[model samples]
Target: MVQVIDGDTMVVMKGEESVNVRLYGIDCPEGNQASGREAWIFASKLADGNPVEVQPIDIDRYGRTVATVHVNGRSINEELIRSGHAWVYTQYCTNDFCRDWLKLQSDSQGARSGLWAAKNPTPPWDFRHSFKLAQATPQSSKPKAPPASAASYHGNISSRIFHDSSCQHYDCKACTATFTTRQQALDAGYRPCKKCGAK
Candidate 1:
């Protein structure tokens, strides 16, 4: 029997070996290293320290069993999202409820609740990659810039065919007025210039 731990990792009591089970179809915030404590608290409440059935769908490279846990005949994964504690792992989720989970996450983000309260929260997978990179490299190192040729030009200015700076992607000649900031123009409901569209 394994007890649900967090969104991703779990603890299974298997005789002497304590198996760490990783749940599928959900990517909870990192509990230990990055908001891991909060994640753990959320997961514990969801699991309530009870024994859960670990239905394995696959085994991850780390030998952790990837499973969809069911407790009291309810989908723990769905509960996590509905409670605004976890997000659907879009990269790996195959369940039909994935769309619903995504919607739940969107709603939470719009409401600025739970994990969404963090400013510019990174996805768990991306956070792991960045953590590894930081551990392997020095922070003082500067990143290389892209080549100048990689830059793209809009178009040649002529015959009053200029892109509205407000809407760079739209070439609207009717609204050629450029504002100091794009937000200002967008607030006025002005579309891109018809002649030269800017994005």
Candidate 2:
């Protein structure tokens, strides 16, 4: 049996030990990124509580087994690409098998399926690289100042997401609608954003 950790990672019970496996030749979006939760949900539906056969390729630097997984003869990695939930990891995929995987991604893109539905979707690798670089760079060497008290809720007319004044997305150029209270935002037909948990 297998338990999905995310779109591209899983934990499998091997004998008495649990083994961490990273799906080979595919990279999914990060957890906090756009469509990241959707990818995870799709992957969970495919893998959770299901019996999967893993073909180990190598071990990653993080000690996760890099492998190809099959669930009832369907290649999970290929399926992810075909379904537009993941990208074929060209940098790490050097084998001849990658050609077919790349083709699958192209087909999905042409059909505008899944992540391809977005006009421009950021790849997980690029997102991770940018995140790492931001972590390494400091905004200021001086001591950080405490944030002010959060104000009442506000809503973005375009996005239909509501948050308090201190929320990251609050009061942006698109957030034209103002609410005196959280309930007012809800009454205005705005939902809480997952990032700030407005409700």
Candidate 3:
């Protein structure tokens, strides 16, 4: 059985188990974004209960199997682009064939179909980034006291990395663990996060 989660996400049943798949190389709008519902409807028709072949690309931090999905030997990824349901996610799309997906997106944008019907469609990546920034932004305009540690360091157990409290990533969701000093993080086998100037 194939189940549709959203425009670019789905689950395929294998007897007693199932696999969660995220379509690779393309990014669709969020569930609440403009034309988001339309994209889901299109994707549901393409993959719902239909046989598909997934080419595993990478496992994201969220543990989603990112891959290109083919339904009835047709590239669902390409179809989404050709119909303006998604944009080429160039950040992680370094493969040679990604160029074709980009071209398809360009054509779709020119035609202003589906999500492209909007004069300026906001990419889902940008939307998520803005949302995260909003969520991570402190609610009060006034500043709060920093971690009572002598030294200023923020640690994330999941990534096993530490960031300078002055760094923008310091108060990220994963960075619940605080460190008094850089040495304290190093002693705990936590390295510095590259995003921040943790050297």
Models ranked on TM-score = 2, 3, 1
What tens digits encode model 2's per-residue C-alpha lDDT throughout 77-101? Answer: 9888999999999999988999999
Ranked by lDDT from best down, the candidates are 2, 3, 1
Global lDDT of each model?
Answer: 0.57, 0.75, 0.75
The TM-score of predicted model 2 comes to 0.70
User: Would you give me the overall lDDT of model 1?
Assistant: 0.57
Candidate 3 local lDDT, 74-183, one digit each (tens): 99889999999998999988999999888888899888889888888899888768855854688567666455443456566457688875688876765634444566
User: Clash totals for all models, in order?
Assistant: 18, 0, 0
Displacement of residue 133 (Cα, Å) in model 1 is 1.1
TM-score against native, each model: 0.60, 0.70, 0.68
Which ranges in model 2 have alpha carbons more than 4 Å from their true place? 141-199
**Global CA lDDT computed for model 2:** 0.75
| Cα-based lDDT at residue 134, candidate 1 | 50
Pick the TM-score winner.
2
- Model 1, span 1-199: residue lDDT tens: 5543345566666678666567788887653234544665666666775667778889776566778777788777766666666778888987786787788878888887767777887777786587447546754756454243221111211222223323354332232122223333343234435644533
Model 1, which residues run further than 4 Å from truth?
1-5, 14-18, 32-34, 138-199
Better of 1 and 2 by lDDT: 2
